[model samples]
Structures are given as C-alpha cells and as structure tokens.
Target: MLDKNVNLEGKNILVTGAAGFIGSNLVLELLKTLKSVNIVGIDSVNDYYDVKIKEWRLEELEKEAKTHKDSTWKFVKGNIADRGLIDSIFAKFKPAVVVNLAAQAGVRYSIINPDAYIEANIIGFYNILEACRHSYDNGEKGVEHLVYASSSSVYGTNKKVPYSTDDKVDNPVSLYAATKKSNELMAHAYSKLYNIPSTGLRFFTVYGPAGRPDMAYFGFTNKLIKGENIQIFNYGNCKRDFTYVDDIVEGIKHVMQSAPARKNGEDGLPIPPYAVYNIGNSNPENLLDFVTILQEELVRAEVLPRDYDFELHKKLVPMQQGDVPVTYADTTALERNFGFKPSTDLRTGLRKFAEWYKEFYKV
Candidate 1:
C-alpha cells in the first residue's frame, strides 16, 4: 500500500533497470503510493545472470499493472547504452523524477569483461545525464529529481567499520566500484552544470526474495542443491550488512519526495541539489554465521533436505581479487535527511530469499 503522507499522484517517474531486483521492487512500490503516476521503466535485460529471472520480474510488474484501474506502468526492453533510445524515451516520457538503478552489476564480472563496464557504466550513464540535461529543453520541462544507484564497493576495503558517506572513496578495488564512483563524479558534474537535482544511493549488500542469483546466498544455494562443494572465501572470515529490498525501496521513496535541493557549503551545494547517502542495514554480520543461518533457513523453506551433509560439502579458500573483507554503513546522512535507516539483519533477509527461491523453483 502507498503511504498516505506521500503523494506522487500523476507524476511521471522513470526507473532505469526496472527488471532487476531492486528496480522491479521499486516500480511496484511507486505504483501503490502515487495516484495515476506514470512509471516508465527501462532495462537492457542482459545475460549477466539468468535473463529468465529478469523476464519474470517484468511479467510480474505487467500483472500488477493489469490489475490497476489505469495503465500507469510501461516497461521498455532496451539497453541504457543506446543513446538514441535513451534520448527518445526521455523526449517522449518527459519524466519529472528519474531513478537510475540500471547498472552493469557485479564486482568480479567487471574484471572479466572490462568493455561491458566501460560501455554500460560509463557510456550508458553519460547518455542518461545528456538526456536528463536536455529533458527540459523544449518548454516548462519537468525533470526534477534524478536518483542513481552507487555501491558499497566504493569504500574499497576500508578499515573503518561503518563506512560513512563523508569518508574519502578515491580508491576502489574493482572496476565495478571504480565505475560506480565515476558515476557519482559524473552525476556531480551534471548536477552542477545542468542544475539537475541528482542524488546517488550507495547501497550495501541488498538481498531479499527475488534478489540477484549471482549473490553469495543464491550461488551457495545452487551449489548446495547440486551437492557441489561451496567455496567459502577469506577462510570464512568476512562481514556484510545484508539489507532487505523493501527497506531500500522505502528509503528511495522518501528521498524522491525530499529531492535534494541545492544549498551552500554542503556536498550537494554549489552543485547543491546533488547528494549521496549510504543505504544499508548498518549492522554487519559475520560471513560464517551468515552461512550457518542461511543453511538453517533453506532447510525450513525445504530447499534442502533434512540431514543434508553440511560438513563435507564446503571449502574455505583465500579471498578473491576485487573482494572486500567487510562492509557496514554509516547512515547518518540518510537518517538525518530521510528520518530513517535500513535495519534488516542477515537471517531475516536470507529467510525471505529462501522462501521465494523455493516457491519460484518449486524445490
């Protein structure tokens, strides 16, 4: 249900990466809260993971839209890398609010395919900025807030426990992180030059039902199902603040309304309307304990049989390149502005994933 306090009625909001986990979820929430709000969502729907899951998310959104009294939702299958397509969509939609969740996600994958990152993250993001700058070109244009996704990877193996938005993020271990950091930089430049109200969200380990299968939980689940030994990195020594998708969606909704207004002497100042925040659980969980809890939940969800051999089917190895030791969020900025912070823990979030995976796969 939409929050009665928040009214996005009749506003045209564009959500890029609408077919991805967080994007699809955000689309649903926007529809419920706003009256007759037209949501135009775009996704390249590449084969990074199982494209089937992406297709399923779109189908689910279509079903939701079909039930609504008015057809306020439109899903476009295309790459953000396509400048012509991005410009055309902007010209037609003339969206008032733009949320960019469309990213070439995954840290390890970025290392393998450097070109994809350059193309999608760099080229694609530039196209978004260009289109957004010119979105109000004609007359009385309504491009207001532009929100894009950043990553916890920007912290880049910091010794700091709670990674704050104020901390220096100059060094990123992976190309993906580097690209995301570049995105923040690019958005900052656009916000300053074009006077676009841009907000970048640096999301921490987001996981939930219908989440990305490439994540550790999903990969581990798949391996466990096939009776293959799951490899534990860093000798099972790592920590993550697994945030629930719903919480992240709610945070975005709140930010959309407030829409960072430029001020003096602030990060978004001068280019004032630009801001960045860390949306995370703010509570880190040890990886070994996380796996144990996840296994228990999988059994409860019936994804795994009782008495599954847990001891023999696992191996702890050294950490991989582009991998971090731990991540926690200092959500002071988010809380100060939005009056809230993500608080979902690993067990609860994993349980949701286990249930959904069971139902989706009928395991």
Candidate 2:
C-alpha cells in the first residue's frame, strides 16, 4: 500500500473546476480534514447544466470556508483553456498541489459540439501541463502531485465486466471518452518529460445531491416531475457502476496524498512518475432496477406523489450513439494502493439525491 506522505497543512492547493460538483465537494472535504490550508479554486461556472446549482455549490463552499479559522478559500472565475488566465493563477498562488477537474463533460454533448471537448479537455489540459512544467523553472520543488479526472467511458464497449486500470483502453467510442484517454496520454508524457508526479482517476457514473443535471438520474426526476416521459436507452438493458459523489471524493482525497514515487532509470533518465486508478463502487446496478429505486426514493422524499405512475413516465428506447450497455469498474488497484473503495449502494445514494432535490427545488 502507498503511504500518505504529503502534508496539506499551510500549503497552497489549486483546484480547477472548483465550483463544479466534484471540485466543490473536494474543497469542503479539505477544509474539514486539514487546518491552515490555503485553497484556490477556479471555475468558469458555465451553463452546461444549471448555473444555479454551481452557484449553490460555491455558496456552500463559502459557508464551509468561514468555519475554518486557519484555512482560507479563494474563488476565481475563469476558464482553464485560457492560457493567460491559467498562467496568471499559477504564478500568483504557487500551489504545491493541483487537482484538475475542469472539462467539458457529457458523452452525448460531445457529438453535438466536438470543439468544446477539444478546447476544454485537450487545450485546457495542455495548459495545466505547461504550468506544472514551468513551476520547476526556478529550481523550486514545484507541484508535488497533479491529480486529474479520467472517465469510465474510456473502456469503450469492452466485453470485460469489471473495467480495470490494467485493461487495454485504446478504443474510445465517444469524443468525450477519447478526450479523457488523451488526457492520460498527455499526463504520462508530461510526467516522463518533466518528472512531475501525477495521477489520473477514472471515475464511474458518479451521482449524488446537486450533481450535474445532465446525468440520467437527475434528468429522469425532472422529466417525471414535469409529467414527461424519460427515455430509458438501450431498451433498459443497461448497468452502471453508480458511485456516489462522496465516495468519489474520498478516493480522490486519498490519492492526492499518495503520489507516484519519482524513480530514475538505469540509463540516467527519469522514469515516468504517473499512475491511473479507477474510482467506483464496483457494483453495477441494472438501469431499470436503478430507476425503480430512484422512483421509490423520490416518492419517499415527497418529491413525487405516492400514486405517481412510474411506468407511464418511462420510455424504453433503442441504444443511443456513443453509449455502452454497462459500466463495471475493477477497483482492485484502488483497493490495493489506497486501502479504500467506494462502498455506497445505489438505493442509499439515490435517496440522498431525492431528499436534496426536494429541499433545493422546494418540490
């Protein structure tokens, strides 16, 4: 098992996409765990879903920041793809640790707007790599670790049940998946070239309260509330390793502390200090079953009437483009290294989301 060696106390940490679901939750976790930590968060706060939710998350972060006497949180509104903005932020903060969570998310959206994916996931990630490289220009032991997000989509219709880090992931069906895979390649090159310790986490179907509204779980609820039928793609013959947001955050927190050790090759060259792991529940829940649980939770939370017609609100449809039938994560590497794995079940996670939805939307 890798040992946790990085000390976060009094250290400057930068989190891109800080107002987004994962980034905001991460900031809150850091404030709770570490004292005297300086957190710098940057986000474009785009209207990919509901901007209100992003603002709400930022509000929560601000509230949490105030509770910690020694810890301070600063929010910057900017795009990661803007090289000048990224450079300026790095120069000012001089963060020792960076968590890059900013990217144009969604599988279907990638088809509609491929440019957005390239600009944000490709160009944006390149800017981050360049910043990390330049941080060492002044002989400063800069950027102890760079942790970024990858996705389960990289598996790309694999026959394998449990998606493993060791599994071959060359086939990416969607532009979004391709970009995520590209990020891993880019990180590896930067790590090998600059000797930067970096890790990439392939998160699987992460959902929770205040999650991206584009996600199926949240979208379905909205459709049901509006008396519109929600599409169940692939004729409801799908399974997802639905990891809760908190569980994903826990995995990230542990990985941030345990970066790959820098090692030198016998040929007098630095071996790439890069690692990637899957952060998921490892339990694949059937789509129809998942919806059943979600509907029950929605009714239990009073977001829907007890007599709500679930069957009437669902439309089973053929498989969509760029979508796989199942996503089952092989988290052996995560468990072996971090001594942790996502354990939250589907019912429990969906219930929390239902309750949060009721309160947030005043349903």
Count clashing residue pairs per candidate. 4, 0
168: Cα error in model 1, Å: 0.6
Candidate 2: which stretches are off by over 4 Å? Answer: none
- Estimate, for each residue in 174-271, the C-alpha lDDT of model 2 and write its tens digit: 99999999999999999999999999999999999999999999999999999999999999999999999999999999999998999999999999
In model 2, the worst 10-residue window by lDDT is 3-12
Tell me each candidate's RMSD, in Å, in order. 2.9, 0.7
In model 2, which residue pairs have backbone atoms overlapping below 3 Å? none
Model 1 stretches astray by more than 4 angstroms: 1-7, 263-270
* Model 1 CA lDDT for position 4: 25
Q: Which model scores highest in TM-score?
A: 2
TM-score of 2: 0.99
